[model samples]
Target chain A: MWVALSYACWGISIVLALWMLYDWFKIDTTYSEEMLTSSREGELEAVSEKHRI
Target chain B: MTIAAEPAVQVQGDRVSLLRVLGPAHVWALGVGIVLVGEFTGWNFAADKGGALAALIVCWIVGLLYTSVAMIDSEVTSTVAAAGGQYAQAKHIVGPLMAFNVALFLVFAYTMLEVSDAILLGDTIVAKAGVEGLNHNSFIAATIVVLAWLNYRGVLMTLNVNFVITAIAYVSIVILFLSVSPWTQGAVLKLNELVTPGNALPYGWIGVIAAFQFGIWYYLGIEGTTQAAEEVRSPARSLPYGTMAGMITLLIAAAMTWYVCASLMPWEYLGITYYPLWDAGKLTGSALLENLLFIATLLAALASANGCINDAARAWFSLGRDRYLPTWFSAVHPKYRTPYRSILFLLPIALAFAFIADLNQAITFSILSGVLQYTFMSINIIMFRKKWPLGSIRRGYTHPFHPLPAIVLFCLCVVTFFAIFLGFGSQLIAMVAFYFLISLWFHFYRYKFVRRGAQFTMPWPKPQGY
Candidate 1:
């Protein structure tokens, strides 16, 4: 049981990491640097300094 | 009228921001969760350096050091309000060079700690299963990846999970303390264990000094609450309250853990063992207590690893955002609004350290990084007050007894460094050389990339001295 669980953990982690890599590249290609770095929500929040839902 | 300046960075695309959903409770969980794991394991090394009584004494002394750290961190973090915590403070108060080094310190400190936590969890599992020489790599990788995934998803869910697991571990310590019933005549605790000859101070006063480095285990990383400064719903209020509350909880927890363990086992045994709390539970001969402690140890490791992911990623992301590393690292997840790239990037680094498998070596590296950061903190706050004196800007919280805390903090950091030298001298020199080299790299290559104009995010008046 323990060995199987360990193997399962290893399998799950590799899958998750691969998924993250795929998403990371996809996002990089899709968004412009200006769009990516400029934070719309952060600007509004920084100015007001108020909590938002 | 208040100054209404343009956004710190200009852009031509849709907006993305980290969720501002955290409150005081989440802040407490973030800080305590990262640190409570120490109570279960690494802290007993202090007994090895001195003795049981010496460990207790050093615990209080180190407690005072962290109290100073919390107070100073709260004041600056409350006003600066950024993700990198001390890195952001260093940028505004000192300069880019100092900020770069501080950011690196925060990254390494958390990452090494995460590695140690994962290794401990893996070893515990193998031991419990009665297995011999099983490879722990898979479990270590699994632990980092899982926590990194959670952090990538969102901060709220990540910290909420931490809060639950951290609370359980804390309550277990309290239960163990009560079960020992030190106040009762037929108590399980052996008060004589403390005063038994060499147990009090075997190596004498110098030993007490030597114990200072490990004493930090009792309350390391409590200042990490400030790393959540950006995500907090109200930094001004939540940062100070959450940080102080976490400090108080750690002091109480540290005292009780020492009392329970020091009383149950001989000083020599307690000093050398990695599973002091669990061993104490076994001594009680209560099957329930032993199992509770076993589970608590596991959960505490998980909680610590989880918080380390959140903090290390934040500091690294903040550096990327400032162009100190690469702007590629700065991108926030469009949907999750988390620093997804930074989280994923650190996964491999954490795994590499975990594979090293020397828990003591890993912890020493983490502690030294932390000590350097704390030393810089004392300097940063002194400069902060000098540059922007009282009434210069709207400080969210102001630390009392200004130079006193800073002075004491600086002095304590010096003593801790000596303690580290006595134990891990070569490692100390290696870390210093490492930072020194990085500082050079930043001054030459990296500084060219940093957008200096945009570095100052706060809209405060001109600094008085600068």
Candidate 2:
């Protein structure tokens, strides 16, 4: 029974991690349209802060 | 009156801001980076309390609790993006005094964690390389200088390095797992036998309670991810997703790391070992694997140190910039937009403490402060929701079950905090005394100098129905 519980814990944790991995990879396309529009503002800010030290 | 002509009136160009250099990947790395060291070390201490099986159970329970907290914190971060994080959450919901207490809890806790991480790195290297008479104090101080310089360069550079170091650390875990995955129930010591009640959970049910202090290691710094809310792009979405990834990754890593290591030996043996992974690698009977595991453990500690230093400095920056603390902490590198002055100010102090502090005390006090900070943040969530009701506020995300999760977590933290304190009588008393001292200190600072009508209302997300 204890062994079963141990494996069950591991199983649940692995599933959660796999789900998060899937979510992490989807970042680029999830908000592609918004990303495109915002890129212009982001570019100017990036340039301004580029050599910040 | 022309807005530009009025010195008090600020324009868009005049508002100083942190650069949005972090994307989803950077946020994910930083979230995991700050806490990933849990996989390498610290988990074994729980074994001392409740044997291996009890410790494993403790890790699982703590992992779930922290994951829940991280999810709730995600919504708060997305709605009101700021460097102040939980501190800012309290300010909007409770008031400045509560906000002050929360900020001090976070700042001091992370600073302590940073110091401890550096010390751990120095000690781990000394053990790994077999260097006698090594000046770890000098080693830690030098390492902090390099880390601070990296941070001063820019957030982008600091996070990029974090991503690389974090990735290597994770890969190391994967390697260790794969190397031992094929072992058949441990030729050295079968896991099932080791977990039998008298063996794995020697102290009985009460020992499980004692184990929670160490259980905190698995997910302690995962919440530090929210400290990066101001730096991430599309914070509403990115912050939540990044933290979810980080929590899930840590949960899995903790379980696997515990399982494989415990499979090799009894908690009696593994629990006392200074480097569990390095020793666990020997059960595979491969020298190459052992060395690889040891190196990975060191890298993991370094990554955590990097993240903790960055998180602590940012917290100081937010406080200093808001005039809650000294304005000197608010000074940013003119070009990099990073809080160089704040990082430098705390670096020496952290280094000094790292040399004298004990490992157990570092872990306990960190969790103690966390207990206070999270309690305030969770209650703040309930209060904020009450003030703005569902559909009344323009929030980035809505948590299901309203404030049930917050209330549940707050109660759980309170109960668990006191329960864990049962084991650390002296430390608990000392922490409470220090807590009072700081409260008095903050009161003096505020009462003496903070003038009337000088403070402005926070720009929290406006309530739609209001």
Candidate 3:
């Protein structure tokens, strides 16, 4: 019975963590800029040329 | 029109085409898939008796530190984005030999883990079906065959399958938890007991440290998602979020599960053989619910295997592309557009390990290799910070205190390296010796045969501002 209960709590915890992360992403739009520079001039062109399909 | 000769290697190129393969959803699925595997295996139990609370805290801290590293990886991949992610990054940052060593350790680690997951999948399936005297080797072989087929189909197909499997895994875990929780009689919820060391370790700061070391395994493949950075759409945005989200979700779920298990059941009853969650389901409900939980375990094992295989193939593909291994290993299927040769090579190694070894030995080898990889990654990040300085790419998610967490993680890794020796005795020594021998072979082959008397060049261009 305890084992079942514990698993339930664990499940709830996962849901909550996912929720928090979602909110964190929503609040900071600029967070993506540091990791990605696609909008910058010459960068996208360079990437396209390098990885031509 | 002038006739042009077709290149012998159609897929052999400087960069991978992101349009043909991966996207944000695939990236998210891969990250979550890796985390689900860690959680499904009763890895939380490994952290249980050894100061569970301390381990939990350290896991969160480590998650933050890894976030920084993930961002770094994202930045690096953007600049030199290729199919061979880590090997390319390592070669660019350090040198060819160092990159080769890192890639070698990763291949050994990931291959061992894939085999271990396959064996566990067989165990889960057999036990759930109430089948006795099942041919374990045959089951392992079959599982590897199925996994290899999935790999052969290509990344998009693999990702789709992974998405479905992960969804089922998440839903089942939720159902298992909800169904069992209502029946608990007197489950005492005490957080204090987690800190008090008992059978797992002696009571001291070292015990706390030891607990953290074991707990790190639960978060082992968190950074693996970064290997797919180049494939993701706008990786600068998706990579950090996906990696951190996956890890944070895993952390919370693991702690909650640990607490529930520790509080609800007596320590003696929750033995190593019986899965605590499944046992709880049996106690609370009918045979049907028990069967459901059993099926859930099977699905979890299968998903975990899939995730491990994907990561392992990518790592080796990167190595082959960097010319650290035989060039043939870099072959991608013409139609499928996946790392076919690398996947084929990995299967035999994984299958052999699965058939010959028991779960404990396989896990030990995997964990040891993982430790080496993590240590090297942490050191590389520090080196980049020092040497690159102003030229180092900006991080989307930075560790709160510059270098402190990195230092702490490094120290934890060093202690864990020693702990493996102490904890596992002769096995640890044998593995380390084997690793050194492999490293020695690479050194000789590269220096004596390939680049004789040439000065060793670091993988990446030296930063101008350093």
Which candidate tops TM-score?
A: 1
Ranking by lDDT: 1, 2, 3
Ranking by TM-score: 1, 2, 3
CAPRI-style docking class of model 1 based on DockQ: acceptable
Instruction: Report the C-alpha displacement of residue B249, candidate 2, in angstroms.
Output: 0.5
Better of 1 and 2 by lDDT: 1
List clashing residue pairs in candidate 1: A40-B15
Model 2 Cα lDDT, one tens digit per residue, A1-53: 33343345345535543443453335324433222122111123343344332
Taken in order, the candidates have interface RMSDs of 4.8, 16.9, 16.9
Compared with the true structure, model 2 gives a TM-score of 0.83
What does candidate 2's lDDT look like per residue over B1-466, in tens digits?
Answer: 0111111211124333456667777787787997887767777888887788878888877776786688688878777667767776766666666767887788787887777677777677666656555445554655565676667657777888888889888887778787665466655446787677568678887787788777887777888887787777667888888888888888888877888878876788776766788778777789988888877777777778788778888888767755678665665443455666677677778877877886667767777777777777677777777766766556777777756778777876766676567778677778879877877887777545443333323444554344
* B1-466 per-residue lDDT for model 3 (tens digits): 1112322323323332222345555666676775565555545444443444444554565455455555555444454444445665676676667777777776777777678777877666556545545445555666676666676656666767777777777666666556545345344343345334453343345555555445555566666676675455556566666665665566666655555555544444442533555654565556875676666666666666777787888778766544567645655554354565677678778877887898767777777877777778677767666766644555444444557655765766776776565567587778778878877888876434433222222234546553
Cα lDDT listed for each candidate: 0.87, 0.70, 0.58
CAPRI grade, predicted model 2: incorrect
Where model 2 places Cα greater than 4 Å from the true spot, the runs are A1-53, B1-16, B182-189, B447-466
Which 10-residue window in model 3 chain B sums to the lowest lDDT?
B1-10
Error of 1 at A18 (Å): 2.2
lDDT of 3 by residue, A1-53 (tens): 33343345345535543543453344235223222111111132345445434
What is the clash count of model 2? 3
